[model samples]
Target: MTNPTALQLIARSNRLGADSRNTNYAGGNTSAKGSETDPVTGEPVELLWVKGSGGDLGTLTESGLAVLRLDRVRALPEVYPGVEREDEMVAAFDYCLHGKGGAAPSIDTAMHALVDAAHVDHLHPDSGIAFATAADGEQLTKDAFGGRVVWVPWRRPGFQLGLDIAAVKRDNPGAIGAILGGHGITAWGDTSEEAEANSLWIIETAAAHLAEHGHPEPFGSVIDGYEALPEDARRAKAAALAPVLRGLASTDHPVVGHFTDSDVVLDFVARAEHPRLAELGTSCPDHFLRTKVKPLVLDLPANASAEDSIARLRELHEAYRADYTAYYERGAAAARARGEEPPAMRGADPAIVLIPGVGMFSYGADKQTARVAGEFYVNAINVMRGAEAVSSYAPIDEAEKFRIEYWALEEAKLQRRPARKPLATRVALVTGAASGIGLATAKRLAAEGACVVIADLDLERAAAAAAEIGSSDVAVGVQANVTDEAAVQAAVDAALLAFGGLDLVVNNAGLSLSKSLLETTVADWDLQHNVMAKGSFLVSKAAAKVMIDQGLGGDIVYISSKNSVFAGPNNIAYSATKADQAHQVRLLAAELGEHGIKVNGINPDGVVRGSGIFAGGWGAKRAAVYGVPEEKLGEYYAQRTLLKREVLPENVANAVFVLCASDLDHTTGLHIPVDAGVAAAFLR
Candidate 1:
């Protein structure tokens, strides 16, 4: 908070930002103009603070607000004042910063400056967008709020639109706010509190009126909550179908699928008008730019095989892509007919996937994008239902939508962005991620920009690890006991839910019984074999099914040990289980090869620190067997190795990374030893 004026503005902005029903993801902006003394120079100057690009309103903070010289921005060279001003406005945004080290101002900065009010709040509320996009939107705008809100027709967001909005405001200074057709509503006040209350009044009163006038109850479903199904049932379905959808939707591009059957979406889908409404396009221009024209509908029967579902989804994907192409071309032709030069449009890719009888899926380059797209579609569905209740859902023309989608400002954003890491969009599941080699590998994968799911039996620890690793965009933790078929399947589903799909599975969860053959008890043998050997098979089997369905090659890596190749003294159960796991890797590689999946193994020894085995007192006993104290055990192994270096968890993780990397892109059914130099463990 700065001056009282700025504090009030920031408070109201943060209040609106906290609610998705108000300002979702990056879809809204708030601005307040006030006098502030320069940090370097004690002279006061008029300053405008607006929500910056790429910042979410719900989490809006002081830093997220871009500070700019108000007069400097309003005076920005509007070379094409009436024709276009986005380029110039953007340039002004870059150069007019009143403070150092802040994000770029929101694209609506020009419009914010033009408005005459001391405080302005803009939001894409469901109720507001529903009214704005209806067929009779202009008239409805006048009737719904009874002319208290001025109406402005759709204009591309920039200087000219700002001028048009200002003209409307200047002409009607008595109105509280104005609704932008096919966009959203903007309200202003002298105080931040008044601005917020005024904006709320417009939205809430509009919503109440719509409800009273029969706005189809939005979703019109029996369920009263957000959930689509019973908690267990929903989770089970997600687990069963996530990988299948992942493989199908990701055929050409790397897309992660987000599943939802919220009451809103489910009710909309259940409606008789659902199919028509689904293809009618997004309700607002901002969402339209992200969700494309429509979603792909798929028929998923309850008893379908994974293969059947995947094959059917693939067909739908191809058809969706083809239809999108036609839609774009038609829009382009229409633009030319209107004597307007069409901008270069990107290729058609279905952003939303509707699976009847199951739920909905949204796809994007990563998890967050997919989730945000899904949220927008849900809001859109509700808005459409509300509009359909009163009148037809009349969104902006295809020309206007094209303008928003391929606008030069957005294109510049694409160009200015940095290149993503090699595995930036890839998704992976790492078992035993709570500690040791699995933990190290999970972090490494996250660092490489792959969305990772840390699956471990230690549910709390797994989640803790995920938080330590990073954002939901990159990591999540799920409890998965690899030995249980149900648990393994659940783990895969969790991975798919968290990351949209799985491209790699690191089967590294392991256990050991350092006992001689005669000394190994039945419980020890069962536990060791079940965890190491059977767990590996269960996880690999589940992973292979997903990879096979994906039709895109994937990787399944087993964390075996050098003991698999060379059994040492007093190690029976551990060595045998590892050997079994190694064989299973080759078998999976052989069978899943046709599906383009690669199966590999990493054999690493002397991982003393950070491993569960070491924590469980295996290191001390092993050191006793080596005729040395526990403290010297690490050094002893290091000296015994050809390289005379310790075999660490990171070393094992590096080998895992190599197997998953493009270097071994063509190789499969191979084992790479991570020990410094083990001639016998080496693969010739």
Candidate 2:
């Protein structure tokens, strides 16, 4: 057997799509080419060979391959208008092929041409597409690969898509492959065989996994509502669908020939099988830029009256457009916040493609692009299904998603760039620092070069913890009760007097009680509330006064817990206090935001080892009290989290550091979870 050449690998992957019973007529394309290297001079030169348009990869020949100077192709989109630009692109290819004969370039030629790697292959593998199609595509991918894959969310394909891929390449210099939402997968390697093998391997792996988990082919299932529509009604339905499809496709994607006749396209779409028609749409986020989150489903029965059907279809279309606009606006705002330019909204008229009687049509710049949209739809369906299974598939609300989508700092950090060292000259005060989150946070601040003052009720224990933190940075231990206003104020004075100024305050002193709401005494509730909730407020107030007096902005972090939101059974006082702490942080943020004093909280769940809360042989006592073995307590909490790992004090420390440091300047009033996804229970 001979090793497959780059083009052969590309062709083989394309054929595999056929074998898997995926792809429709001109539905997906494949590309394989290498960067040009000067033979005589050995200089690296721009070179790319892509599958030309109008040719299926299964039957593609060398003549079907189009060659272009990579540099020139990458620049085409900027110099021409939509249709004129595409025409000029083909013309350029023709001029390049004057001497050497090959097929006209692919519609996605620009994408392949712009990628930074020498050997690149692009395909819309079914399994890969299916995985991308899900609403939890990122989580699904993580579950499938166990944290070994790179993923890029859906974006409109064209210059923007090319740019995104190029950026990913730079970020993951050694990444095996990347799954593009709704669009497909881009696999690269030192050689074509490696790229193709990896792509095929991932697709097969994802498919087998999904099949094992009961995700069948998306189209095989019968759609309940629209299977029996009338013919005249179908045409009206298709017309109604056109705008919704058009709105989703938008104007930013590569404008191919199929996309030009949006109205006629929808007219044809109105007559197809409803399920099959919807399946024809793109399946992932990569397709979102082109196809909105979901496609329109127009049902026209052969026996139904045309007038009634038309009215029904119009109503459906209007509903779809309204939903799509809302989704787009939400997504646009998120994208903008994440530093990504929003897609141009051409008009109120959507980019929908209508299909008669059968369903509606939604198109992307290309097939893979549409597949991305389809993937999102599929994921949405899965989410709906899972929700049904568990009574509801609750996800983070729109506001939270919006925050994540628009968070510029978060997106920047995804590249794992080391955050800026911002506490070089800062001074910090940490309470309850003898052990647990407080001690960990104090040590962390000291490590970051901040002068740290560790305060605790046990002076000796605080001194011991501070000593272990080292002697280089200014670290002192003070004995004080966080709940006592005078004692807390004295500690603050001592810290400021020692360090000359204060910039960060971590109110980490707290107590937890595990008693039923009715079984708990009023004194227990007051004690827990006064220490954890009231104590945090007093410490924050003192810190803010110092910060304001110094004329320098500062940060205050309250240590909260997962119980704050979930309210674990028998933990009423603890849960309520933590919840109050979170609210207090929010109020402080609003009050001090303008003054440059940022306030935030870290909500940790199940933190073990080096934490006093869990150190008093409480796990054993609780286990005995609950009739479970002490050994199982760790497993109990760990299993509840998505990561299924113990929540270490170090993890909480890292989060506290992130919140207090300047890296979180725009992140005030936020509650960061260092709970390994436990709060996701409430989200789900």
Candidate 3:
């Protein structure tokens, strides 16, 4: 039987987490205390059910809660080794588990276990944290709630801090909650309903106080030259600069990128005090954990040209790296003095970038993470705005920030993350991806952990295909006509902005017409060559520039046809274009080898099903030429192949994956036939 109190706890948690004003994503925990029948003893025992580690309160479920014997949890302080070894208490949480326990306990477990209230909420709400991080945070807490909410000094979260809050609760008889200086707010009540209400009351009270007494322009006046560029111009500049910023951010490892041009970001970036406040960094641990200690602010106005901005950004990046290294050394030195070994440096590249007049760009290993990082920074901006309004905005000192950034516990959490997939962090762009081999290939790459861009002439179909593949962060659909240079370049730019940079390209867009040299029109010849031959060249040229600039090797796979090598009849236009694509693969492979970019090709005989070309009319035309029914074309082609197997779009997609797979890193310039056992189409 499920405990009703546990259900109520999850319900309360979801309600609190659903509101961004209550807490940032995955930034808070809630708990409920109740008595349950102990299976072993057949007697009632008090238990604590709290949100577990690394879970979002909004998505809290029964399985996500950690259950422990309240009596045993309260007894932990007796064995606690003091503040210096407080982390040891976290592991101790396991010993107090009731039955199978539940999810692993979070560090915040100590707070819930030590508190006496029947229900508790520890949240990182922007309104409450504003006063929590204020310069005179203790005084502000008293003023905001008139002593209903007490104040506790900043102490890194641990057993000691939990004990500190518990002592405050015990000392203050009527206090409903307490604000942790330089951290966040915590509230409790005798029931789940009361607890939730108390939390909201604290948040609303703090926010209302700030708004009533705050300055009208807390962020300061907009700089003369830093006014936001017109919307179109701002987005265009952001797209152009994305690749450069991505390259700089990938100094250590490749990362995905996210761009946001919301009004809050625009208003903050254009203000005179943006740089000063940005350098001070974020206060709450949850904010800094995602946004980093501080973002790298581009020192130019939004109207600056891409060429000039890119040049200056490079210079700023070099300096930023050096300063980061210095900061690490300072923390390492401090650790050594205390006889502790510092953790290895993770990366020196900035995770968040602030561009005046444009907006913010945040980077991470994947799309959701990148987006969340940006959201965290927005929360930081809100906290700063509120803090400065009531008092000076003051975050934790640099040394403390470094300590948390490289904490051993944080390192262990990273180590616990699942292993990366084969193509993890790799970004792929596929032409004509709305259907057929292109769509199949896009789906395949995404499954193997690659971020994908589905490019085709039809925007609606392309977007639908991308949606089928994954979420917006993982795959994006783009309208592109391979024959148009501008469209091809735009597609490449979209990939860079959506996923940081491109590492793979599939030239799969083409049309087929079954016509002999005598029957083929000039227009037919031009159409085939323009899409398959010229289109591939445009995409390759555009993508190669970004790959070269990124200084990371890339792969280009051309989807040619068996007709490229075989003397198939009545296919002059199609055959010639396929031959053109096949040779270009080898040529580009040799030329781009110096840059570590691999080029390869796949030759498939007849992909009838799911093929846009075949479905359009090529299937009937080919069936007539081969003296077979249109519906039986696939069967007929299968019977003729040496392997007696029909070639499907998935078969071609598999061949593409093999050519680009890491194991074939040294096998560039090779053409693998996906034509089953067709001897004539074999590469000589």
Candidate 4:
């Protein structure tokens, strides 16, 4: 009969995956076994279904489970006493799967299969790892669980680990779970309920033991738990530190940086004892694979100036990288001593960075990955706090760490992720990105893997829009009134600081006025000119300076309206300013061409849906202009176009994206239209 426990296992596994307090994205694995008849032969067979490699447990489905024939998997000669070839061991694993659809079984499957339980869970709970990595962890677990759990020293994941765990299980037949020193924990039972409960029991017992001994919070505030400081003295100091650190921590290619000063991070980094203790290494083996061991910690001085801070971050970055090279040598030597040829290691760049006076930072190729690194490090800090409170904190020895750091399997997990999108390493800034074409463009660029800065006058709305983009690392919302030089400069700084440099600048901020010339006062004309014409110039000017400094040919796109080219009756002020803006693009293209910069203009017509202008009564005003009801404005405009189609914000955004396409290296000083075949507005 097929397993009746699959539902319960799925439920419990998802619960564990969903809670960051338990594990972060794809950090743990789960499995369940059952007996069933083979589909092809109708013969009774035992099956093992475990979480697939690279599959997210939080949203795991039956399709994500790798179905394997249990008898075949357990009998593989790769696990036999005489077999030691990791390649052969890997090949053996691939040979046992029952189907070809799901992802490859997780590297932990062999260990899970050997547990001799219907249900098994392997979790990287921070609380459990605290006791596991404690200086006296071996005995601490023993004392807390009173032999209810077994202790297994760290070993690289493979057939050998399965054998070691099996041996431990054999020795302690009464124990429900075991701790893998320097790694995570494994628990098993007849059902997922029993297995999860026992796992929670082990975690709680270890966590409680530490608390009972002395529940001490790590040092965060300047003055105990009462009134104290949060990181550096001023908010501006903390704000200024992000970009400088981002520039330093980034690698040769591209890695986005994320900063967090949440209370947890501050407490962990602000501790007087952290500098020495933090260097000990990762909370678990999975961490060693994801974030590497240790982090690049920056020491912020009292009342540091901007120049001093920048210089300090740069100096510290150099030292951090140089120290990594030396550490890599020691690790490589240790690996060679094990009689195994060490793989050529990459530069020892710490994935996590802790700043004593601010908070913490994590780097990854993309935003989601950076957040994962941040979450894992935060978990580590909390666990380390608990472990140190109980006794001295300790992690696995250097020899074992060397094995994990160089593990072919652990490295494969990173390399196996999907290929990056075309705009993978680029950073883009979209002004007026709170809604309409700007918002659409921001989403498009972010989806293409570019770090996006959403600049708008309304920061609260812009931030909400950015959050909807769903990757905080790539999407940042900054408040900017483009007419104000300082606000414009600050927005530019936010982009450059967060992403190391800026590449694309979209000058899309604008306002529309439809008053007749006779009724239009000097005030209305100035308001339209100041925002549409002057704002574009100001934002563009600031952006070019940064691009010139980087010496990287970048793109600057101006989103001028269709009125720029076609004279609409009541749009004199808007059209006149737009014409000036469109001419500005050609002028910029001429001037910036020498610096390898490309400048272009996009004129969007009839984009009503999701357009901020239309939402602000522009639709009703335009409908009145056309002598039609307000609700039919979209239809009215669509019918007026040759293509008989509605021009949506996405249509405008697509035109902007085309203008920004990488292949158009020589195609600057152009105006692309998106108005469903508005022949008059078309670029000739």
- lDDT of all predictions: 0.79, 0.60, 0.91, 0.77
Query: lDDT tens string, model 4, 1-684?
Result: 335655666778898788776666787788888877777898888878888888777888777787788888888744555434654565566778885625587778888787777888888888788877888888888888877898888776777787778778778889898888777888888877898888888777777787788446543234232221443353345556655555455554456666666787766665666777778877587676667778877666435565676677778778888877777788788767767676677655667877655566787777677767887888777678877877777877766777777766666765887897877767799999999889999988887778899999999998998898975677889999998999998898777556646779999888777777897889989998899799999999988886675556689999987888887777778889999899999999999988888999988786788888787877777788889998888999899789999888788777767777677768989888777778888766
State the lDDT of candidate 1 residue by residue for 1-684, as single tens digits.
466666666677778877777766778788888988777889998988888876777777777878888777777645544464355667667778876826687678777888888888888998888888888877777777776788888876777767777787789877888888888888888877778888898888778867888554543443223224555765666666676666666655778767777766665665556667777788587787678778887555434454676578778878888887777788778767866665676656677877554578888877788888999898888688768777788888776777677666777776767687667677889999999999999988888778889999999999999999998777889999987999998888877767667888898998766777799999999999988888988888887777776667899999999989975888988998899989988898899888889999998976987888877888888888889999888888888889988888889888888888877899999998888887766665
Model 3: worst 10 consecutive residues (lDDT sum): 403-412
Which of 1 and 3 is the better model by TM-score?
3
Residue 390 displacement (Å), model 1: 2.7
**Total residue pair clashes for candidate 4:** 1
Q: Find the candidate with the highest lDDT and give its number.
A: 3
Model 3: CA > 4 A from native: none
Please, what are the lDDT tens digits per residue for candidate 2 over residues 1-684? 211343564566466445533333343455555445555678765556666765665666666667665556666656645631332454554544322536666446656666665566666555666555455667767777753457878754444566677777778766666777655677666566666566677767766676667523332333334343454444343333332233233333321112222232333333323334343343332232244433555454433454565566557766765775676587787667756665444333233333333333334333333333333343334423322222222233344343333333223323353452456656688989889888878888877767788999999997888788875235878897988998997787666434445678898997766788898899989999999898998999888876775456789998888777885667788889988998998899999988788998888886767778777665665566556677677667788788888887878889988887656678898888887778553422
> How do all models score by TM-score?
0.92, 0.39, 0.97, 0.87
Q: Candidates sorted by lDDT, descending order? A: 3, 1, 4, 2
Model 2, residue 85: displacement in angstroms?
65
Tens-place lDDT per residue, model 3, 282-361, is 88988888888888999998778899999999998898899889999999999788777878998999989988888899
